[model samples]
Target: MLLPQPRESIQDNQKGKVFFVALFTVCFFIMHYGIFVFVQTSMFFAVSSIYRGDLFNLSIPALK
Candidate 1:
């Protein structure tokens, strides 16, 4: 059976590490931006809904 050389194994390990690091970095940014946008949109919708409700209440006259 053929055996792996020490230098070649080291190089392979380095390549694997680099690939994983790059992948992690990309996924981290994507998740971060996704969460940020989701939160922003949710807040905007919540605020707008509350504002609309207040406007509706204000426009309606109170019954004596």
Candidate 2:
């Protein structure tokens, strides 16, 4: 018969799982939000430049 594992070890394993899940969720949200913001900003700049008749001069604000 297989012996049961200790309770402390089981609890620690569960805690580790929870920590990794929380960390993954936070990282995913940050990456998604960052990508969204980047796309939106780029599109806004592109449109604005086109509207102002300077499409060729379109550049990131930070590069100015």
Candidate 3:
């Protein structure tokens, strides 16, 4: 037979589980946001670089 757990202990256990789940969810969102920002900035930089390259080629006809 299983031993009976105290009500207070069971409540505390449930609270801890909830806290852990909340912490995990917050961390996951933060990590996801960071990755999204990184991708956006990287893409912006890539596009800007390509644009600059085109401008540079256009400005100096001797380079062509």
Candidate 4:
């Protein structure tokens, strides 16, 4: 009976560790994806503004 108790406790500890590791991995992936999307959107807007000639006047003034 006592032998079974230690085995059960060890299994529970392992399960808990696995659960936390998986949770952290999922959160990390979500955060990385969010940052990637934000950067892509910002770059798209910057490129579009430049393409529309909106940034030309701004650049000329900066060069002066």
lDDT of each: 0.68, 0.73, 0.70, 0.68
Q: How close is candidate 1 to the true structure, as a TM-score?
A: 0.56
Candidate number with greatest lDDT = 2
Model 2's lDDT to the true fold? 0.73
TM per prediction: 0.56, 0.60, 0.59, 0.60
lDDT of 4 by residue, 17-37 (tens): 767988999999999999999
RMSD of every candidate to native, in Å, equals: 10.7, 8.5, 10.2, 9.7
User: Which candidate, 1 or 2, has the higher TM-score?
Assistant: 2
Clashing pairs in 4: none
Q: How does model 1 fare in lDDT?
A: 0.68
Q: Give the range where candidate 3 is weakest over 10 consecutive residues by summed lDDT.
A: 52-61
For model 4, the stretches where C-alpha displacement exceeds 4 angstroms are 1-10, 50-64
